[model samples]
Target: MNHHAPLSPAAELHANVSVPFERAFAMPKSVYTSPEFLALEQSHVFAQDWLCAGRAESLPDPGDYLTMEIAGEPVVVLRDRDGAIRAMSNVCRHRMSTLLQGRGKVRAITCPYHAWTYNLDGSLRGAPAMTLNEGFCKEALGLPAIRCAVWQGWIMVTLNPEAPAPAEALAEVTDLIAPFDMTGYRETFRESFRWATNWKVLAENFMESYHLPMCHAGTIGGASKLEEMVCPTGGAGFNYHWILKNDSVPLALAHPSNTTLEGDDRRKTWLLAIYPSLLITLTPGYFWYLSLTPDGPGHVQVLFGGGMSEDWLADPAAEAHLASVRALLDDVNVEDKGCTEKVYRGLCSGLAQPGPLSHLERPNFEFAQYLARRIPA
Candidate 1:
């Protein structure tokens, strides 16, 4: 755990990940800057884990769908005719073309190449002009199915067919977040952006609020008091903490219907990181999340969404409130982008060695531990 330790693959990893929370150091810069390590994570970590897509509520109707890339594998996530959500390979069975591009609705997923069509359930329905090929059996050809499920209203797809259900791994906190009514929050805004940093960097940043008072001093961070924060113990798949806010701030105010929380919960903001890359922040009046995907060791794509609670959504000032919230969040994001990108540049400088973790950075310690176990030895 020494900061000045000589750098090697194993030594670098050990330097960052092998230490107690109080004496912990940041993961080596190589962990974020090495393409070799990114490839390893793609295979052993992302490919084997259940990754969150957007909310299932986004696709309320049958045949509605969204597509995302998981560990370099393109996947189609959709609700079929029977209202069952399914994840299947986006690669068409014929000619290997991407069947769906992005989020949309369709009676059937039809390939832009060669006109191969598939039913909502991923069954091959037609293969035009394939009669000439006697070996081509339409019934036998279909989009390969991937493991998928809707848990707590979020759509999650795993590239590994044998992975356990996402809900099962997340059970430790199911009751903990029940008060937030995760399913009742409808997405009112969405933004997709890329950060010039590793996905883990962004994930670690979002999991803890240690830098809030400084990084976001002018916005929501102004209300964050470090002394009042409560960090939950790490579990198999998640880490969370609650930061109590000043009651006078408009941003810290509670929703009218948020009666489930009492005392400190009334003014507390909850931040939860669900395993590898799903980060959620819940307040009494609103909730937002970041679902991150890595494009490379130094590039991360983010799917960001936020929404109001049922109480606020019913208010006459909902739109105005939402606009203000969005603006505040945008400012916070800009600040974060600058901070993380700069850190990435520093890490790439070769002089950036592992640094000691703060008491507030316990979540980062847990995250490093999680990554260490899954990364190739």
Candidate 2:
């Protein structure tokens, strides 16, 4: 079942559990700027969670693979000669070097360090400088491999030794979309942008809807009403759900309805930020999944992908919807970047105190709780 455990006593205590209408949160500035805390988070949060790395559809054929980084570990996902998708370290096990620099077809992963080669399935295929049988057994010298699994065309990966199997951990991300039958949808647009700010700042910014009226004023605010927007929270923390005004999508699309959407159409559009890093949006004409990857404490790369029918993939849809999404994103990003930098600087002013959280800011409160749980004790 898709669910979230209740907040712990300490978590509830740190963030006042009573207020239902306040926007203030008391997250420590250190969590945003401390060098020690960021390193601990890499092991506790990024390396341990089941993350959506890339789409399985992108690597559907044999020898096809994408060079990517999981948490901070360089890795590759490839369809082997036998047509099975496998996850393996993109680093050569012999001398510990990068195998592939970028995404492409490869009969074998050859290391630039010493010309060591590995099959996509991670078998030690060739080593020019060393003897095979006289040295390490090819069977025993395969590249290190990690577990990966696909659901609804999304490829999720993990580096944790004890992380639940991909299929089991992702059952929740899948069940949430069961009503939409996403297999029929195909990726139409994919774009990524690197921002000069902390990734957690972006996550905290996206976990709620309070900024829509102010930050998103030019785009979504220009086209619709935020006051009537219905946002409810779910997921591990307080993720959001809402239907906007004037959301007119085709009935044949993912959300099929003959009725035209007016003010506050509850089923018109759905926006959710899944725990940790995934941002998912389901609209009348399309659906998009975004992953927020932390390059370092002060840097992040936002990966965005759009989905639609075979027909829409060939052409664009209503300009207003796409424009609103992009503009709202830009506005929110600008607002968030300012705070991230401010917090990055503020943490140094000796105001780094653990403050209480208001319940209306439940998502941010839970975010602090999540960081607390993930950081090593």
Candidate 3:
């Protein structure tokens, strides 16, 4: 008898999705509905890849910290005493209690359960009434460290120590948009919320601009010309598209004093979908991004943030521009939330099936392939 193992449902779906762009179809509905599929992604993709936590600038001072979960593992990214950003387990070494909650400045990582304190560097500093235990050693009992690096100003953390550095993996992206000086853009605001949809559904939504005219009709739709949207084949770690338009928001275009980006380049907006789950909308005068994590098969956790470039920040009308940008983004987000949730609802129906791909959804096609390559059959 032949010893061939049958392909998994995910692998079969992947095989169907891995065709040429012209013949490509949307990812099957099971990808968004199956708990098993989500588990595979959690282990093979989220756990193995460099996941963006937030902007490094947000954790500038020593003891500043932000907490997030990766594939169910609690991780805290913080600036240590030496002003170096690092990541470590958010679980306390004693009693296995969570070390921190949300984001804030802390002198030490202390577990509220028993007051087992760890320094900002994750080294165990104090554990009350532990001297009686003969096996206890504070030096060896510090919180476990996770691999972390800053790439283009974003703080990235990984559970796999052997994974490639963010810079090395995103080298092509770095060169592709170098003139923008993405690292120089400051984050003005960030908010975390849950969405009623699969993480991939939201990721695909961000990867394509095909739905702007219909889904975002009330907000930015009038300004979004589908004819101007260009979707090219994606790179190994990311996919990107371009929208060249005279922006409705003045600050969205390049500043008069700025000379780096010339001509139409000043009005260009890059929709970048970094592999697994970081989505960025980078413009000459401003930038915004969404970092996504799966809450379950039916829900996703989102870190939404955006801000202005240094030149725009220095402009006399900066405050008004920022307020306008924030208002527009908030409205856009409301539109997206409704659309994505409806998609998720449809995926739950037995009648739902993968449809043909749009030329503008090339990035989504590439994203399906990426998922196929990562999750085992």
Candidate 4:
């Protein structure tokens, strides 16, 4: 009688997903549905990786701050008086109350519960009524700092001190996209919302162009040509694909006055999925991104933002162009919401199984491998 021990779920997943691209299939249903898997990912992947916070330019002055949570730890990213971006614990040292609630300019991080104030640099500025306590030491009570770095204008933070800097990890991507001068693009707006779907479902949806003609038919679908997309093998820190745009959206192409990009490069769009969960759509004229965080096993929180490049912003009809782009993105997001939510629903069925991946889904396959490598056996 054969008495081979049963494989643990993580071990089985690792074995199944670590195959060559030609033999790859979609990830198992448990990857998106299992609470235990999600917890493992939170501790091992999200907490250890360099997560994109937002563009540094968004916090133009000292005291401008944004709050986000990483693997259940609240963090506040702010500009100090010295004009450097900093990330620190948003939990007040005293009583452990959350110090901030969203993004805005602030004079200091003040805990709403007890009003223990912290300076922009996260040093304790004041703790009312604490002077009598001999054990209290203000010098030793600053909010603990997290590792923070800026790469290609994006603010990245990691709780793990040993993670590679974003710029160092994404050096190849920088070289490939050098001509576009991504840092020259300025953000115009940003918003956050929750969607009722697994985070990876939305991430995979963004990684491939296979569903563009069907999922986004009413919006940006007309510009996507399955035959024109190029999906090369992915690198260690990222996956990418390219699509040549049609004339359907003028802003999706290079501006008339832009001389930096020439010929076919002007109409090409790069879809980049930076490992873990930062998805960027970079075009010659504009760029947009989605930063994802898992809210739970069944839901994802998204940070959506976009803007035009310096050249496009200087155009005589820039406002009209931006308005059109925003409108189209809104419609495309609605379509994606519907599609990803349905996928999650199907994965919940007892009979649901992963199918073989299409050639265009090369990026998705690479993403699965990334997850498999990060989550321990």
Candidate 5:
């Protein structure tokens, strides 16, 4: 008898990541379940790319801020005294304590451990006992800064200084999304949940509509015909698709603010998956996004938020209208969560392999190509 070592599932799936769209197979189970691959994605894919932290509207006033992590490095995104948005390492310069846990309006970022304080601009403002140390100049110490950009009201940060600006990278996407007037939309709701799936799995899942008729049957899936979905081949930065809604349907069938949009644009929905981790869905009346972050090989954290267009927010029955929309969105999310969780479980069972890709899953194909180009074989 002879003994042989088995090939790792992740190694087996590496070839599928770059297969042509028409001939592409589903992502390999190892891609979702391997710690090694997850580590690579964190370093090469996320750390080097722009990531969405949250909506700028959430931090309306100076000193308002939010905290998030990229490639496992903690970061704080805030508006400084001069009202400019900035991003800096959340780790305290003195003892490495995380400066902030969540969102709040703060006059200055002060470490909970030693009360070492930093100005809104990230300059060191106070150090409790550091004056006693020789040559410890507060002027010379501040939280390490990361590149930050505000694009269409979303706060974006990148660990790599040389990466493309968010505005420049999203210039085409901005034009495609401009008619909806996202800058005028006010973020009204936010919710977060942890999923037992790889970040890429969730990203690919949200980017496709082929599963809608089956997976979201009871909520938004049945409202549109399968034949009406059209996915556009996007360029380097992102990919999108249109799902035309029936005029008689209840949700987003007829938005009062859609008067400015032309025939199909007014009646359909745009689903865009920005490279790396931002997933956006824009309709005539409202838009929502998910900023995805990987926790580890086995989990991902999703920061989900949405807004109503200024016009829709001004309707006399806005409260009741939002209530209905929220209910539908909540249900639809539950459906997605259930499906992705099941897929992850199946991938972990050691019997998973790549399956044929559907024409409707073109965005997933492009995303696979994006990852293949970045991650080493």
Candidate 6:
């Protein structure tokens, strides 16, 4: 009997830099395992680069405030009485107590630690014990503001109070999905789940389709072929676009005012990944928004939300479809996270070293390279 080749559960590491351009793409596994690297990313990457925080629809009017943590720094986003959305440090200027405990709306944030109050706009408004500190100046003690920008109805905040507008960096990403009426779509359902793998592993997993037929068979196997998907990397290694097949016939109606698209343009499904973190997927008439946020080196939280036009929200059946989509996708994500976490554990083992990247996993390789190049050599 002829002997069969032994099977291996592994991927090839790319060493050639030729055909894909001069820069051979690769990211070291340590980028995810080093504490110093994570801190630098917080101050340099997450703090300086735009981090998508909340949705525009959430800030409906003045006094509406939402709180979230950015690179471990707590921040509060709110629309002031002037109707302007602003991101402010959640830390009260006085006594250093955090201004907002969690997410919600409030007329004004009053620190429970000392009863110091701040206007929704982040200005110091009142102090019950102003006389207690003769030198305390309310104007000088106002909460500091952060750089805030909005694109495609999503809010992005940067900690560098004077960082340049993210419009230029995020503009192209916005236009890529402009054909769809996104703002008209509200995040009818929202969720956050913890993944057991390195953030980069999850990111890499998302950046390519090589494993779709193998890894996603349970969820995306029906009308999709991983071989048919596309990954064209550009934008300083920070942006990449790819397509996926969807089984649903409802999302095919996305032909907008471009006018050329008609009722017949529904044969294929397209998915685009806006680098660093954002996946815009189209299925039938449904638009899915997937956000990948890093919690720690091997721990990440996936944010799943968005889809449907406001008109769809008005329909009673909308909730059912949204719920169904979330449930299906959520199940698939759980499976992926478990697999990636195992990969991370293997990487830390002294028994093995890093390997190659397949031509099919180019997107994944490109992502690893991007991370490698960004961190200090």
Give the C-alpha miss distance for residue 153 in model 6, angstroms.
Answer: 0.6
Cα lDDT of model 4 by residue, 276-336, tens digit: 9999999998899999999898999999999989999999898899999998998999999
Better of 1 and 6 by lDDT: 1
Q: After superposition, how far is residue 316 of candidate 6 from its true place, in Å?
A: 5.7
Best by lDDT: 4
Off by over 4 Å in 2: 1-24, 170-173, 230-233, 248-267, 309-360
* Clashing residue pairs for model 5: none
Cα lDDT of model 3 by residue, 176-253, tens digit: 899897899999999999999999899999999999999989887877698888888779899999888565888779
Per-model CA lDDT versus the true structure: 0.84, 0.64, 0.90, 0.91, 0.84, 0.65
Task: Report the lDDT tens digits of candidate 2 across residue range 179-257.
Answer: 5545655665577787766777777666656666666664454544545555454555326655554533342243333
lDDT of 6 by residue, 200-301 (tens): 777776666676676777776555565665666555425554554444633334423235334433334446555566666654356666676678777887
* Residue 360, model 4: Cα distance from true site in angstroms: 0.4
Model 2 RMSD in angstroms: 6.6
**Residues 3-105 of candidate 1: C-alpha lDDT, one tens digit per residue:** 9865655446755776678788888777888888888888888899989898877888999998899988899999999999999999988778888987889
Q: Which ten residues in a row have the lowest lDDT in candidate 5?
A: 248-257
Clashing pairs in 3: none
Give all TM-scores, in the order shown.
0.95, 0.78, 0.97, 0.97, 0.95, 0.84
Off by over 4 Å in 1: 1-11, 248-252
Which portions of model 6 miss their true places by more than 4 Å? 1-26, 161-164, 244-246, 252-270, 282-284, 310-316
Better of 2 and 3 by TM-score: 3
C-alpha displacement of 27 in model 1, angstroms? 0.8
Give the Cα error of residue 371 in candidate 4, in Å.
0.9
Candidate 5, residues 196-232, lDDT tens digits: the string is 8878878988899999989998987877776877888
